[model samples]
Target: MTLKFLVLSSLALLTNAHMAAFHKAMYCFNGTASGQVNYNNDDPVSPLWMLKKSDYWFHHVNQCDDFPPAPGDFLELPAGSSFTVEVAANRGVTSLSFNGQFATDWGDGGNHPNDYSVANLAGAPLSSSGCIGNPNMHTQNQSMAAGTAFAISYQSDISQVTMDNLAVFTVRYNTPWKRVTSYDVPKDMPACPADGCTCAWVWIPNGCGEPNIYMQGFKCMVTGATSTTPIATPKPPVWCEEDQSTCTQGAKQILIWNQAEGNNIAVSGFDLSGNPKSPAYNSKCGFQDGEGFHALVAIGNVVSDTSPQEHRMTSLVHRPLPPQRLQQLLHHPHLLPPRPHQLLDRLHQLWRHRLLHHPHHLLHHLLHHLLHHT
Candidate 1:
């Protein structure tokens, strides 16, 4: 049996009405690590893929019969780099091609090739699905050498005649990120020690082997020592900063302010003079380079409501620490109250422990709490 034979057989089983009912197959790539690779997920048209400075997936979408690019034009990867294929169809994926070689032995009628269904396509795994087997359970390309480019293609059954909701994604960690240390808050803001205030510091990892952002000094609770509610600003539209300020170029400076729903912090960019550029408006304040910052922002008292709300600038940093490492650190016998000499260091450790352990849910909960109360 040949690939053409299986395709024809699969087509024969479907009725004309079924063919016309469904007309699109979505293709995409999954499993790329954060910031390792870049693709335009926003642009449905003219999607681009780049590994470091090199181009990978770039093509035009046309009719299914003549849409995919040539094999030589397919994306290339260095040795040890891999990507997976995701296929979704209104009807079903009926034909697949690799390097211009068609697979024939996909069971009968090519129904569910290699036990892959539409669900699998939507749930694309982080790794490659491996090549399809022929009669001997072997692919046409037995070996993949380093620094090679290859093409992959799939065709939907007659019902799938249109292309929509189709996309491709690729992940490559060819280059590592640069480590960034603490970002200074707006200058006039009080440091750690202040009247009627308790302070804590937290450092989130940026995967570049450095603290992405150093958040120091959170406003301490004034009363209710036994409560567990989070403190928030008096109301939205309140500026977390007493005055809007900018830092010199290369100075990691951030401005955090309160809004009706939640607080937003903007990481300022540098002008040619290396001075931080201020935003025309507070809401518009953000990283000028267009890179996002990721860190855990903790404001107010984690202990109770009615406490003075202290704002922390964090978020959008890439590559965080592992959960297991955080869990182990929590169980250490040395984790204890901070001494007068080590209060600052202890505060930093506490922030790290809380953020790493509850990165996702905690952020969501805090955001929700702030939004609803406002």
Candidate 2:
């Protein structure tokens, strides 16, 4: 009995150490003030997935979908308005308000037992400017924290929602920093279908620790929509930190990084300044308010394609090279001929045709030709 008790205590400690999630999310329907407040129970839904792939990495294994709420219990997204949610390391801390009181105390032996601050888990000031006190939460740099986004899929059924159709409408930069966080709803957003829409809160940290992502689902409905135009299809975001002009335009899909499968963007290198070109849910990564093809055209980048093949080809040729490749070429500019634009176009064509099997080999071949022939 003593040995078993020790093991269970250790497990509980481990779970409490790295726990953080939105307290009022649909998955926490079982949480209440008078009863068991932590709806996730002892399972602990906020553990990092590291580099390994698991169903828990995204939407916490769809536990929220399984626990469907009754009508009118859905999260309301008022178009052109904002909504707030309490984020904490444990649901119990958020539940402290049920008794008409707030959890303001900090440190190890606080009123809310076994709970840590969602923003500053150490319960003290951070010594450094980057990555904050706890490496797990990655809330160190207030101006550079990986932003969080809210995406809406018109499907009322959670299972029917996928990355392709779930379009990010608004992004809150430098978020997951405070216990109470607010997210804006796009003014031009349209109403969902009759049954309502499936929404998700997605986040990818800006490289303070292990590269893990977060996605939590919510049954949400637009309460005050003024537009009838549907959200356009979402495209995978690109690493365009060096050049905002080259960023992918229109609605963007939620980032899926460090996963074995279902990864939409693959960035394995640093930028020109030696900084990891991590794709985030902010304006630097092409996500903007009222994003759509029509919005792009209104901004004067008119996209006219006669055929589907033409459209694909146009997007490919115009797409900027991957950050790693761009960094390499920019660092070694002397190897290029007098007119580098022609060579760049050729490289884009080669990339379009999938002729470059290995990126390093392609760079080597190009450099060799430029050195010997040019």
Clashes of 2: 1
lDDT of each: 0.23, 0.58
Show where candidate 2 strays beyond 4 Å.
Answer: 1-25, 31-64, 95-102, 105-130, 134-136, 289-374
lDDT of 1 by residue, 1-374 (tens): 98656644553432211101011122221112233211211111121112211121121121222222222222221212232221111122213322213222221123332334323323322112232221111111212100101111121221221112111111111101111111222211111112222222211111111112211111221221232222222111112222323221111222222112212243345533353432211112212221111111122122222223211211111224365643553444233222221222333453566743555644453444445444
What is residue 45's positional error in candidate 2, in angstroms?
A: 4.6
Per-model TM values vs. the true structure: 0.17, 0.63
lDDT of 2 by residue, 1-374 (tens): 67445434433442223333443445445542234544323233353443333474344443434555456667788877887765554444344333313333321113322233335444443424344543234654466566777778889888788777887777777665555667787666678888888887777767665667777767788888776656667788887776888876666778887776778887767865587767778765777643433421212122442256444434444455665665464446443333334356646555565655568856875776578655
Model 1 bad stretches (over 4 Å):
1-56, 60-374
Give me the candidate number with maximum lDDT.
2
